[model samples]
Target: LLLDIVRLKGSHSAEHIRNTTEQILDHLSINDKVYKIITDNGSSMIKAYKFGLSVSDQNFEDEEANDEDSMDVDEQIGY
Candidate 1:
């Protein structure tokens, strides 16, 4: 269900739109409640969702590395 709406002025770049959407998601979905987002097929929305929960490319890379590390640990544990 739609819970809230926000209006923005000026140009809406992908990064800007992502920040605003994330802010709303932050207020609405906490403690890992957020899973997926659905939006119009606008290029800006597509790009914004691509950013995921990471604020920077470096953070995304770090997450990838951590995930790989966890997989290695799992393999060692006979999982």
Candidate 2:
């Protein structure tokens, strides 16, 4: 069910995506009813749902965190 189609004007960072999703769920009063969220393999989407309540995989989270850290370092050094 497509509740709403929002047009975001600014950055599409992980935090922004998470906040936008939370806001939408809250507005619809269905935050607690959401079991899973399906999104593309984009980094922002992955980060936004990485630690979701329904999903529990410490190893996966650690791996993703390490990957993100390395990417940050690489970006800083102009990789």
Candidate 3:
């Protein structure tokens, strides 16, 4: 689900976007729930996920791969 959208009036440099995205993730308390953040093929988005969000595109950065699958199944059944 689309939970939030942050709009800025100033320039959106990579560093700025990274910081903003991190803060938003922290504020929402959904950091662990996030796996992959689908975004446009923009450098800022890629950098935000890599450097700022610190998440890999292919993996969820978690030790247990099954944890995410379990979470997905749980969410599907309204657990």
Estimate, for each residue in 5-57, the C-alpha lDDT of model 3 and write its tens digit: 88955777777776776677789997756665677878877776674345555
Q: Residues 1-79, candidate 1, lDDT per residue (tens digit)?
A: 6757788777778888878877887787651455456889899888888746534556556768999999999999999
Q: How many steric overlaps are in each model, in order?
A: 0, 0, 0
Per-residue C-alpha lDDT of model 2 across residues 8-75, encoded as one tens digit per residue: 76999988888888889889988766656788999999998898734346655776899999999999
Order the candidates by TM-score, highest first — what do you get? 2, 1, 3
TM-score of 1: 0.56
Top candidate, metric lDDT: 2
- Tell me which of candidates 2 and 3 scores higher on TM-score: 2
State model 1's lDDT.
0.74
Off by over 4 Å in 3: 55-79
- Candidate 1 Cα deviation (angstroms), residue 73: 34
* lDDT: the better of candidates 1 and 2: 2
Q: What are the candidates' C-alpha RMSDs? A: 7.1, 11.1, 7.0
Candidate No. with top TM-score:
2
User: Which RMSD does model 1 reach against the true structure?
Assistant: 7.1
